[model samples]
Target: MVALDVVHASNARLRELGPGLVALFVGGTSGIGEFTLKAFVKNTISPRVYLVGRNASAADRIIEECHGLNKDGKVEFIKADVSELAEVDRVCKEIQKKEKAVNLLVQTQGNANLRGRDESPEGLDRKFTLNYYSRTRFISNLLPLLRTASTSPPNFARSVTILSAGSERAINLDDIELKHTFNGMRCANHTTTMNSLMTAEFAVKEPSITFSHTFPSVVNTGVARELPWWARGALKVLTPFFKPFFVGADETGQRQLFHATSGMYPPLKPAAGSPVAAGIPLPTGTAIATGSDGKVGSGGYLVNWNGDITGKKLVIDYQAEGVSKTIWEHTQGIFERVEKINEARA
Candidate 1:
């Protein structure tokens, strides 16, 4: 496990990146998202942030705290239940009209449970919609804004999604949605895997934007407490029983903030900076990548909370198993199926 200090120092270095930065954070209402927003708002000066939440009060409080921290920065509150496509679309349109560019998009929206299968009015499963598709929909709709917001030479806008990093082992490729059968662990695994696969697919299309699907390992932000009642009780009892315990909400948030601003992670980097070397070798046994676009790291990366790249071995294993291609196409099909069904009903 990487030290928290390393992550914080890297985040400190991101302050020099620039000004007029705008970040749109969905599900920033509580837990890690809320903590990350606070850390970011504190780090950047004169920043503009949009806190998207279904609860106006919570958003307003966050805005107040941000304003309190950085008087020069401005915070806008947007209310929407992200699981709903119509709401997600509306927010994107409103954002498009107002902002020419978007520097960061953080998606931490979704419920953590397997109580029952929940589907939105769009006929898409609510759990899948929030955890996976809503982020994709938001990204697709705001592509123009993201492109505009990125720095010239076109590589600045970054999207970070908070996912369970090491939960790949529980994935069920045959039933991605877990509709036929659902257990909490199994469902979380499926959602996390889908997020990883989908993030990889989107990275290919938007080479200019950097995307990271990070698993914040066992953050004790009471995030798991948001699970259904019985599950909450079980987690409360067993979480303390586990060794190498979870990090608290504040630390988890700081690590996430590090990911949000630092270009150290995959498919995204500063257009003119180099984090790796030409001829020098490193002990991590990490591979050096050269992109045709003059960008340092242009390939998609699966990252851990400590900010050091973990799960590459597992991701490669998944790719070798032929699960990667199938997963990507399945995700696209889900999006397409939803669109067709929505149109026919309309």
Candidate 2:
């Protein structure tokens, strides 16, 4: 487990790099995204950050607090319903119009609900879209700029998407989307496994940029807001018993920021001569994390809540069967079909 002290120490060193970092947070309006983004602003020196979500009021409050934390940092919010692929494209276009490169792209967007199979207007499953499709859309749309950032030294190109990292189980390869056989549990497993597979693909395909899929264990966040009153009450009544395992909001921010900047998760091929220094220098006595490909220094990481990588073996056999190609092709088909449908409608 990466200690909280080490998380703080690495974050403290961020400002020393002096301000060329450009970060984009896809779900920064609230929840884990906001927490990590604020911690990032606290340590960064005048970073140009784009905050994407549908909440402008929340963005105002977050920006206000961010300015209070670091008055020089620029936090701009692009309001959009990210469940739609077209909206994801629009957000990416807006960011690309202004910035030449984006150093960090941290995605924590999701529809935390048990409503099951909520399909967006784009005809994709809403929960699946948020958890897997949209986040990948951000990474795909922004790859050019992210790759551009990686070409530079201290400014690293990293993408982090938060979902159930360790819960990757054997999914139905015939129906990767789970469109026909959808349930809450299946949705969770399918999306998490897809994230793992895609992370592996991106890591190999673009070894210069670092790719990580994380699972933030249990934090006291609005993830339960959509729960029914009875369920919410039950959780509240049982909160204290499980409180020991809960990571505090502050610590969540710190740990996530550590993931964002720490050198423990290095690229397959470092952008600069010194690969180990991709983000902050590696912490004392820690080796580079083992990637999802079952190899060290593979540039793709499936991280756990405690800021360590979880090389879950459930997907190993599928990996041997070359599942990454199917995943990438399926994902690309979704993106292409969605965009074409949107354009045709227009």
Candidate 3:
């Protein structure tokens, strides 16, 4: 696995990859997305950023902060509840109307620790809607704009999802919504699984877009604090061990920036002589490579916290049987249903 220091070196080489680019970040008002957005604006010059969030004040603060740091990049904030389909559609449509092309789309809106199953007014579970459905909906609606922003020949548009690495486990396809059984850990695992499935599906259908699902190592983001009091107490005890080895917020942001702009992860193959540095830390456990068609990466990458791309593991211990296909079909069905329901309401 590549070390963070090496990833920083590669990041230096990727300085201008994001300049003058149009990036849309959902969940950028707080947490990892916010941290990464800060890094991008500080690191890159003259970029236009679209920051989407649920809070107007937080968005405004982020924009002000970006402008204060780098007056060159233009920042726009769109207030939208990402869990809702209509809001996603509206915001995306508005963005498309304003910008001719969209260079990067980052999805980091879902929260794992939802206390209970809360269904949206549209008859979809609120957590699933935010974690999976809304993300795909935004991607589907923004494809035209994404295609417009495509860099020909070598550079492809980028799509990135911030998913926990825990997704590499067994998922019951029959109960994606987890109505029968519900808990924070289970929800978190499912979120990661959905992200992996959706990412693989996107990779297959859209070769022009680079798809990445980064499993960020533990960073002391207080995301655990957002959990139940007891869980937070438990995690607090573990923070000492986690922090030293954990990827810091800035590093996480930088790694994500690498994924969003460096064109490193997708097409599932690194070009010759590029010699990109690895991004994850050592002991980055083995990863199963997904092929260009979403099988597994032969030359495929298991992204580490440091940003290096490593070879796939000898044993893919996870149960991937039909998971990808099931996720694809289920996701598409959700989108179709959401669209029709939204249209009918309209």
Candidate 4:
């Protein structure tokens, strides 16, 4: 596990990297995303941040807080419900029009609804869409900008998705959407596995853009707000007992920032000049991380909460069985179907 002192020391170097770094945060209005956004604004020089979420009031307060921390930081809120693919596309278009490239893309948009399977208006499971499909859609739409950032002045581009990493369970290829088997635990495992596979595929396709699917461990993000009253009450009663195990929101943010900029997860081709150009020191202690392909620094990483690489045997076995490619094809098919439906409606 990487020490907190190491994470903080690395994050403090963001200011030295200079100004005009552009970052996009999905679900940044609260929880870990908000914490990371605050840390980024506090440490970076003249940072331009795009905060995307459905909460305007929260965005207002967050923007105010960010400005208070870094007077030169430019933070804009683009309101959208990320659970829908069409909405994700619209938000990406809006961002693309304003920025030439994006240096950092952090996605922590998901819910912990334990009541049961809830479907969205788009005919997809709400949690599944928010946790996997919508996040993938954002990455697909923003690839060009991320690619551009890799070669631009900042010269480094990375995407980090906060979700279950090391705890990935078996994925049923035939039941990709979990239509046949729909339980909360099963759904969580399927989405987490999909996140890891799809992220690995993306890293292979775009070696220049570092991709990481991280498990944030247990944090008091209040993600269980949609749970039933009984479950909520039980959680409330047990909060005092479980609180000690949860990581602090601010510390999680610092570790996340380290994952985004550190040399530990370097791009396929190390950019010209020292690793410091991208903001952190050269990777030390841990050997260069093994990518999804089992090679060192091939540009994809599965990280755990303590800032360590999570090389799960199941993930490796699935990739060997060609599950990653199959998952990618299945995801593309869903996106095509969604696009056709949207076009017909239009």
User: Worst 10-residue stretch by lDDT in candidate 3?
Assistant: 274-283
Over 4 Å off in model 3, which ranges?
112-114, 151-154, 228-241, 268-302, 308-322
The lDDT values for all models are 0.70, 0.86, 0.67, 0.86
Task: Report lDDT (Cα) of residue 45, candidate 4.
Answer: 93
What root-mean-square deviation over C-alphas does model 2 reach? 1.5
lDDT per residue (tens digit) for residues 204-292 in model 2: 98988889998888888877887888888898899999999988888888888888778888888886575433678888977788898
Encode model 4's per-residue lDDT on 176-250: one tens digit a residue. 987777788888898999988877888888877889999888888876677888989999999999899999989
Worst 10 contiguous positions by lDDT, candidate 4: 274-283
| Tens digits of per-residue lDDT for model 3, 1-346 | 5456645655565443546767889988888889888877777658788999887998988899899868998999998887888899889888988887777788888764747877776777677777778888888888887666553312436677776643454576668768687666677667666665566567656655666767666765656645788887887787777667877788888777765555345444323333221221122343433442335542223354555442222113231455667777877877778779888888
Residue 299 alpha-carbon offset, candidate 3, angstroms:
10
Those runs of model 2 whose alpha carbons end farther than 4 Å from true positions after fitting are 153-155, 274-277
How many residue pairs in model 1 have overlapping backbones? 2
Residue 140, model 2: lDDT of 91
Candidate 1 lDDT over residue span 197-255, tens digit each: 65665666776676777877776554575577888888778876773676777788788
